[model samples]
Target: MEIKEVAYDHPDAVELSDQVQAEYRTRFGYDDTTPLRPSYFDPPRGLYLVAYENGAPVASGGWRAQDAEDEGYAYGDAEVKRMYVTPGARGQGLARRILAVLETSAREAGRIRMGLETGEALPEALALYTSSGYTPTTGFGVYRDNADSLFLAKPL
Candidate 1:
């Protein structure tokens, strides 16, 4: 698999994002209304990455800088987003690789921490993040009030 940095609106990136959200919608019966502006994944403040195999996007993820008051986390937090690997890509370690890239990129960008919110519906994601050193934390951002949301964080 090859990973490429791309804008949030990049065709491949958007396709994967939509596919993942569709799965989430079907599993949780809710839509994620997180405020997502392309600027959130713009360079100097954030980044998005897509993993492709044989010219098809199989996985994607991104990180955006966050503020303290609103993020409910420390300043310089890089909130992870849209982490997904297609059904066929499962068990191939693509998601973990993508996550490692995001973490490294966020640290290189001067972020002090990495934060993310994933629902219990995705057990694989929970395991991936936890095994990658992320620990339970107070909920933040869009899912802050969602009972099903499981918040996690890791120091960069």
Candidate 2:
């Protein structure tokens, strides 16, 4: 698999994002309503990545700076978003690869911590994060008040 950094609104990135949102709708009974903008993934602040296999996009993930205490984020925090692996690409370690790159890029950008909000419906994701050294953290973001939401963080 080849992982390439791309704009959050890039065609392939948008395709994968739509796929993830569909999965979210299936699991949560609605699409995630978090407002996002392409610029949020710009360098020096954040990054967006796409993984391709045989020249077809298969996975994606990104991170954005988050430091607003009112939103429950810590200073120098980088929040992960839109992590996904296409159904056919499952079990290939693509998600792990994408996550490692996101963390590395965020860390290099001076982000002191990496944070994300997932949910119990995504057991595999929760497992991946926990095994990668992420631990439970205070909720934040749009889903903070949702009982199904699970927030996790790891110091970079």
Model 1 poorest 10 in a row by lDDT = 67-76
Q: What TM-score goes with each of the models?
A: 0.96, 0.98
Candidate 2 has an lDDT of 0.95
Candidate 2 local lDDT, 1-156, one digit each (tens): 799999999999999999999999999888888899999999989999999999999999999999888888999999999999999999999999999999999999999999999999999999999999999999988888999899999999
RMSD of each: 1.0, 0.6
Residue 144 miss distance in model 2 (angstroms): 1.4
lDDT of 1 by residue, 1-156 (tens): 899999999989889889988988987997678989888999878999999999999999999999867657678899999999999988999999999989999999999999999988989999999999999999888678889899999999
Model 1 residue 22 lDDT score: 97
Taking all chains together, the TM-score of candidate 2 against the true structure is 0.98
Off by over 4 Å in 2: none
Give lDDT: candidate 2, residue 73. Answer: 93
| Model 1 CA deviation exceeding 4 Å by range | none
